[model samples]
Target: MTDGILVVGDISARAQAAVTGVVKALEKAFNAKDPIALSEQFALRTSWSNAMGTRLDDRRSIAESAAPAMEGFLCDSYARYDVVKLLEIAPNVIAVSVAQTPTDSSGNPIEGAWGATLYVISEQEEGWKIVAGQNTAVESSSA
Candidate 1:
């Protein structure tokens, strides 16, 4: 017997592409250590939490908070972001999950520094902007 295909509700491909594009932009900005460009990916009034659990509200706060890290300890660190899942929660709103792997200056993956980030993005007048997000560190299990 032949198996039937499964369908998971209707989601616009255009919207998915746009949302993915925004994430790609963020990854690019982060790799470049450009705080301004990174903040531009978020909405004016946003709720964001970093891996260290620091909460930042609004784009200005996000920029201010990230600038120091980008120029300090994290200066030589880079990361690769991969969109793991995308769900359309509501019209024009998308919930996205991404996996992040920290890497060194030479693109070597850092040990035990993986992270996962969840972002709630909305399609605004300008484009898809992250309205809320939280980044959590993924602990490595020792066998």
Candidate 2:
């Protein structure tokens, strides 16, 4: 393969990994209900925004945002994430389109899926950190 093509392939691979790893870490964090583990994956200055247009720009605020859903919920009942699309928007920026369907309280698939969550991932010295993101609820799911 040409040097240019080889370089492009490498870049793509790295992007893919960054996107995949970040998504997986999110999933693992929720699945395990391990906030500290989740915190480790994010940068100290991470910013998280909720579906309601609320934004949390600090670690304390981020934890506060995630605490509700994770609290009292069984780790086994968490949802799994599937990446619908992964795009390399910039040299170290990745956009991940992920679909997440919550299972019932008993850890079984719910009658219908909740919705998809879109995430913007950035490469940090520690790892992939979510500097900004937004989520939308899918109300028209046929299930």
Residue lDDT tens for model 1, 22-139: 8989988888999999999999989999988999999999889889999997788798777777777888888888888877766677875788889999988788999999998887
lDDT (0 to 1) per candidate: 0.82, 0.65
lDDT computed for candidate 1: 0.82
What digit string (tens of lDDT, one per residue) describes model 2 on residues 1-67?
2222222223467667666777788778877787766656556786666556687776667676666
Off by over 4 Å in 1: 1-9, 106-108, 141-143
Query: Candidate 2's C-alpha lDDT?
Result: 0.65
Clashing residue pairs in candidate 1 (N, C-alpha, C atoms within 3 angstroms):
none
